[model samples]
Target: MNSEQRMKSEVEIWKRKMMKKSGMMNRITKKAQDKINGLIPEKAHKVITESIKKMVQATLFGSEYLTKPKETYNLSLEEKEALIKDSLNKFRKTAVVEGAGTGAGGLLLGLADFPLLLSIKMKFLFEVASIHGYDVKAYEERLFILYVFQLAFSSEEHKKNVLETISHWDEVKGELVDVDWQVLQQEYRDYIDFVKMLQLVPGIGAIVGAYANYNLLDQLGETAINAYRIRAFNRNEITEEIPLDSDK
Candidate 1:
């Protein structure tokens, strides 16, 4: 198979993984996360959800200034992805540097990494959309970016649902008018809570922060690439069949 065909095969594998059932470790994690969440006050949850909602909205609407001019419309999938790889590398470095700097500052600066890393992730997604020949300026495309974010960090069950939406994005895009901000914030926070907590440590914070941010960007890069790949296939009427079994 050629490069594009190979990429399609890889996307197939990713789709199956996305739809696969949560493993033992995942269940354990979810159980712990749920218990911890239950201990937190409802008011605190509301505040956090609202804060995340506002932060995301501000970033989404204000990110146009951060986007580069699109020049990938004429490029093939392989070529566009080559550009995306370059973009991913650039963002990964930025995330790592920011993570280390903030982590070194202990609790105060470690807290700052949340918004900083979030902006970096969203900005990278915007650029990826551009690379895939999509208009990030459009409302639906921006919403799609949020779904991509959710898919990367949500629980197994939620991830499957988001994957289904993404795989058939064109058909379902009209129905998705707004995001479930509470779910978004909760899932994202729970997903990274442990590592981020470690990033507040006095001595090891720098190393943990740098490592966590690098891996997070790596995960985001994979998700963004395949999410757009699924869209590409959908547009061409070549979408793959994702397994629906709930068992690993």
Candidate 2:
């Protein structure tokens, strides 16, 4: 086909992927909602929204899927691996120099907000996979974690400030410097648990950040934590909100 035909064909394919008319898309949306409900925190609603926007923006600009989603070429396993590795390394280079910034142009996985510093980095990952793509989840998770850490790790320029900030939680009263290593590690462990949960669903690893977008910031913000804890504590008052169509 000509360039025009190819471009049109790619757009058609993207429309199919973005369209939610089919029940196929409904399942994805439901999963997204469930993830949101499971994760939404009262405090950091803005964080989640920004994160999703970053994810979508980053995917659109940084990923070939948005520009040439339909383009395909035969590559050996090694070649594909090399491509992913290269993309990941480039992203890491920035972190090794500067620290967490907003994602999308600012894209790299925003780490400026979380006082506890919950971050993940999936560098050079391919676009969304399908039911068959679930087998490689661990690599994706590792990539995500490394991508975020690289921000903290490689930030040579802001090394002093980033380190100082990470060492203590800046509070309204004063800087809580000299952070407890144990607590920071615990924070990582907590976020890792959520990452593990994403692996159970096929094609979700790519969109794991997206799925977490609705819940992670809120949970970290402790906005819903209190309410949820209250509901847990007062079982008698719990209404058990359930979606009517969920059963169907």
lDDT of 1 by residue, 86-114 (tens): 99999999999999999999877877787
TM-score of 1: 0.87
RMSD values for the candidates in order, in angstroms, are 2.9, 22.2
Over 4 Å off, model 1: 27-51, 63-69, 239-248
Cα deviation at 243, candidate 2, in Å, is 34
What lDDT does candidate 1 reach at residue 68? 54
Give all candidates' CA lDDT scores.
0.81, 0.32
TM-score of every prediction relative to native = 0.87, 0.24
Task: Residues 1-248, candidate 2: write the lDDT tens digits.
Answer: 96434433443343233222337654565466557546634434445445434443443334322222213245432343344445444534433222222222121233332321222232222321111121223333222222223222221232233322322212211433222333333333333334433423344432443334334332222211121122222333424332112122
* Residue 7 CA displacement from its true place in model 2, Å: 34
